[model samples]
Every structure is written in C-alpha cells, then in structure tokens.
Target: MRLIRISTNYPAYIQNFYGQRSALATQPYAQQYQTLMADCYSWADFWTQAFGKLGYEVWEPVGNAEPMQKMWAQENGVSYEPKTWLTDIVAAQVKQFQPDLVLVNDYATYSRSFFTHLRQICPSIRLVIGWCGAPYSGYENVFKAYDLVLSNIPSFVTDFRTQGHKCEHMHHAFNPAILKRIKQEQNTPIDFSFVGSIYRAHNFHNQREKLIKQLVAATDLRIWANMMQLSAAELKLLPLKQQVYDLVQLLKRLPLGQTVLPYLPKLKSYARMTNRPGLEQYVDPTIVARAAPAVFGLAMYQTLADSKMALNNHIDISKSYASNMRLYEATGVGTCLLTDGQDNLADIFEPDREVVTYTSAAEAIEKVNYLLDHEPERQQIAIAGQQRTLNCHTFDHRARYLDQLIKKNLA
Candidate 1:
C-alpha cells in the first residue's frame, strides 16, 4: 500500500510511533516536521519514515520554507504577518511529493493552506486523511477536500457523514518507546495521579471545576495541574499582561504528574480562547514531557503504571462518551481506573469490575478514597483491566483495524 503522510512531524518517540519502525508493510513513509515553525518533535516525521522502511515510497515536501518561516514569526506573537512566501515555497514541495494520500494531523493556521494547495494540484489522489482529536470547528469545509476524516469520537464521524462525506473512528496509539522509557526511569510505586489542565475553566461545568479544586486541596494525594490557578489574591497581585504569562509559568512548574487532554482547538474554541495567552507555546513536545512524571495519566496502556489510581473524565462536548483512551490505559496498567460515569460506559467495561465509573464529583472522590483504603479490591480491578488491554488493545490490533478500513473504502 503506497501512502503519503503530510503531518507536522513524524518522529517516532514524539508522534506516537507513526514513522519510525521499518515494519513488514512500511516502505516510503516520507514525512517532515516544520522545525522553523515549531520547536517540538513532529509526529509526521516518524510515520513517514516508518512507512518508507516498510517498502512504501516516502515523499516529503521541503521546498516550502515559507510555512516554517511563518511558523517562526507566529512564535513571537506576530499574527499580522503575511505567509504568501511560505505558501508558495510549500506549493512547490507539494508538487514534487504528490502521492495517493495526504495524512494531516492538527489542521492549524500553520498547515491549512498546505492541504488546500495539494488538493488543487492532485484531485485523483485516492485519499486525504485529517485527524480530529476534538469536537470543535474549522472542520466545516477543511475536510471537504479530503476523502476521509478520522477521530476517536463516533459522534464526530456521524455528524460528518450526515453532512455527506466519508469519515471513520480510529483510536490514538501510545508510543512504545516513551512507555518503555518511563517504565525504566521510574521505579516509584503506582499511586493516584491526574494530568492535564484546569485552565479553560469556562469550557468546563461548575461541578467539574469543583472537582478539580477539590483534588488540588487534597494533601494525601499528589495533586497536579498544568499550572496553578491564581487565587483571588494572586490574580489581584499581578499586572494584567504579566498575570497571564506568570500563570503559564506557574503551570509549567506545577507537577501535573502526567499529561492528558491533547488540546487542538477547532475554530470556535480557538476564538473562545482569545484572552488566554501562552497556550501556543505549550505545543512543543519537550515542554510536554517535562511535567512531573512520577504519576501521569492519558496514554491507554502505559499510563496506568505511573499511578495506582488514574482520574478519567469526559471533555464537555456534543456527546458524553465514556470509553476513552485513559479507560483502557488505566485498566491495562493494572492501575485502578476511576472514571466519570457517562452513557454507554458500562457497555465498554463492567462498572466496578473491569473498571469503575462515577457520575458526580462527590462520587469520584468517594471512589478514590475507598479504593485507596481497600487495596485488595483495587488490585483486582487493576489486574483485570491490565489483562484486557494486553489481550485486545495493542497497537498491532488497531493497525489491523486501520488496514481493514482502508481496504473496505478502496474496494
């Protein structure tokens, strides 16, 4: 299968092993990370190389210095700059690397035009794939140019398909190397840990906000957040512009234990976040890897080993889907999974059996407290969940699912 992947970066360790391995099926996994545009490792680089090694012809377009140049300008907070030069340069590269499919990761301002230009040049391409990690906007017509759109959310696929385009549900993968690295470096016993941010406070409910606050208050547990929230006094204590940056710095220093919630803003959420500064800078992988690693959550299988209890909550969106990446990760690690109870959650895993679910903030707290006190029951749930992940949810299984989907669509 000859495919072309156009992502921001394709480095294996960073992009969840999309482009590093020389597998049986991979040949030319041509990919590139826009280094001038962003300072982080790119997932595109990893996948492209992986496919290339597997016997696919890999073609990466690098003639576009304009995209990287524009990305560099954006890094310093200059949004008014024109990227015509960058787009022209990238267009030349696109012409050279033309292939059957174009795999897109986050479709931000930096790479949107790149996809549009590719479609203009090659309409007969069998597929153009866009990965959606969230249920937000800017996807209205951006995906219209593509053959398929993929996301973990089934509701998202339903909405797109209803609008008259083909789409599919593809779960995200954990990088085996990163997991292996974390496992090797930390011998610390697993304990309860939560990763991700409590900022974007407006996007969450009062109850959800309360739950986060309560976790912050608990001393027995190691509470972590992307950054510490400003107390009423702290907010009042700083200068306006400086306050935001200070908050960002504070969040960087605070031990989040583990990272969760990959935030790629769709159009509306992007606009809603006007007042929030310093968010764009956090996209770098090195910055992400720095938060206190003693306890982390989010990865489906490897994260469970970071802590005994992993907090799993649904991001407020159009649907309340309970079965998330963390659900599997926590279970797979044999870490006691305490997740928010959502519709259809029980269908995915037996409540209080393979995994445990809670409907309210109080319920979540109570469950965590109970699980901490009852070690034997906690271990039982952990073991069951771990066994389930190992048996059913490995990347190898998911890869086959992708292969099937591709064949069905092509046929």
Candidate 2:
C-alpha cells in the first residue's frame, strides 16, 4: 500500500526551497520561516518512518508557500487574497502518486475550498484520515471533510460519531526513537520540575493554577517552615488553608459552581476570590530563575532523563482521563513521573508501581519527598514504567494498531 503524510510545516519547507532559488533568501519572512522549518519535528516524522517500516511506499509532498505568505502579510496589516499555489501543488502530487491512504495531522487552518479541490483532482483516493488533538468545538465541519477522524479525546470521538462520521479513539503515544533514555555525565540536579506552559486565568488552566499554588505552598512548608521558625499556630494553619482551598476548587467543579459563576463577578468583594494569580505567584522566583528555560526536540529528552522526577498536570478539558502526551513521553524516557490523579490512570499504569499518581498538591509533595529519599525504589518504578511504554505505548505499537484498523475498516 502507498501512503502520503501531510504535515503542517510543509509550507515552511516550500518557502525554504523557493527562498534558496531567488533573492527571497534576503527577506525577513523567508529567514524566519527557514528557522521554523529547521526546528520543526513532529508526529509526521514518526508516522512516516513507521509506515515505511511496514513496507508501504510513503510520499510526503511539500505545500505551496504562497497562501502562507499571504496569511503572514495579512497578519502584519497588509491585506491580500490567498493564492492557490499550495492546492495546485498538492493536487498535482496526489494525481501522480495515487496514494491508497492520505493522512492529515492538525490540518484545520487549510481552507474548505482547498479540500474540495483536492477531492476533485483525486476522486479515487481510497481514504483520508484526520488526526485531532483538541475537542470538536470549532472543527466539527472540518472533521466531516475526512473519511475518518482519529482523536485522543473520547468525547471528541463520540461527538463525531453522533454526527454520523467515522471516528476512533487513539490515545497519544511516544516515539521511542526520539524519546529514550539518555545517559548523563553529571548526576540529576533537579529534585523535581515541571516542564509545561502555565497559561493565564481566562484559559481552561484554572485547575492547573490552583494545583500549582497548592504545590508551591507545600514546597514552602517542607523547605522553609523550619528555616523561618514558624509558631505552632502557623504550622497548624497550613493544613487548614489547604483544606479550604481544596473545598473551593471542588465547589467550582460542581453544578452549583456553574450556577454561581454568572453572578460571582457581579459581587465586588467576592469577585476577588475567583481571581487566580499567575505562575510567578506560585513558584519561587529564585527557582524559576535557576530552572532551565523551555527546551524542545532532543533537548527535551535530555532534560527529562537528567531529572530525578518529572511533573505533569493535565488541563481541565481531559475529564476523567489522563490523555496528555506527557504521560507517555516522560515514562518512555525512563523518568519517574508524578502526575495528577485521574479516574482512568490505573488503566494506563499501575499506581505506585509503573507510575505514581497524586490527587492533591499535599499528596504530590509527600510522594515526591518519599521518592527522593528512597532512590532504589524510585529507580525500580522508573525502569518498570519505561519497559511498559516500550512494550505497549510506542509509535511502532500505535502504527501497527492503526494499520490494522485501516485494513479492517477500509477494506
């Protein structure tokens, strides 16, 4: 079987190609796109490599840069009609290659007209699959354009199926080739660290913000309470404060929370209670300054490998399930993971064995402290987690499952 994988960075690659052939090399946008293409390493790489291993001829066509360039110009306040160069190139490639299966990853930004044009050019294309990461909030119609939709979010799959579209639940997986154990020269320096973005309150990160604040408080209690010589009353107040914070967070998730949300902002003094501080307020400034800046690609693997323990916080959207990529990537690299508790976590990893889960910040702190003090036990769990990932959660495993599904359904 022949397969074609479409990547979001194809336009950047095309821009780089044209930039090299003309004076466009000197343009600022061309230079910027070139840098981005160089840094781009994503799921397309893993999927293509896996399909090739399965003895399928794979063709990856670079998209036309004209539309992307026009979009960039518009973003900079210069209006221009989008060119059809990308669609033309894609159509020509599809007509010539005659792929049995075409896969698109996060292709939401592409215009509907382009997809219609693609269908016109390649009428006999066996199947077109769309892989989605987010919910089907704005992209419901986009999913209809594909023959099948694959999503990590179960709710998204159900929603698509309800709309009479073929959708399947495919969990996030790790690429063992990219995310693997890296032997470090120096010993692990960080006792514990989280390597994900912390967004503002307006986004769906309120749960994360609260959890992080609670963790910060726990850290302070563990490291600074004795140093600062707190009184008995202060020590007693710490747990009480955490309990109250937990109660408030719980109430926010209840139906009563939704009912009060509309009116909560109207009350002046009560509105302040709903406000959540940014990451700076929760984390120690000194720790933040000393922490390594966000790393990507191969450097991320090294960072996880060098850390004694890596932290993971799921967004509020992934209700009842641990559906983030971090679950696989951290464990795949042989790092002892400490993640927020989810209902379906035991289904993925054995609690306190293959991986560790904590329901609250205080529990996370307690587990982290215990794991740090007991090195051998932590190492054993990390090794078990790594083995489990390699055996059941690698890209090769996911690819094989997808291959079977395609053959069974599309046949």
Task: Write down the TM-score of every candidate.
Answer: 0.63, 0.69
- The segments of candidate 2 whose C-alpha lies over 4 angstroms from its true place after superposition are 9-40, 59-96, 179-186, 201-203, 220-292
Task: Write one digit per residue (lDDT tens) for candidate 2, span 1-411.
Answer: 888766554343445445545755445654544443433234535766677788888765435445444444544554433454455555656676778888877556655565676777777678888887654365666666788888887766777799898989887887877643355533676667676545433334557656665666566311111011233565567566555555556666799975775675543333335543223233333333334444554555666777778888776777567778878878988889998888878878888899888988778999998998999999899889989888888778888989988897787
lDDT per residue for candidate 1 within 112-148, as digits (tens), equals: 4567667788664676777776645655667666667
lDDT of each: 0.53, 0.66
Clashing pairs in 2: none
Give the number of the best model, judged by lDDT: 2
Cα-based RMSD of candidate 2: 11.5
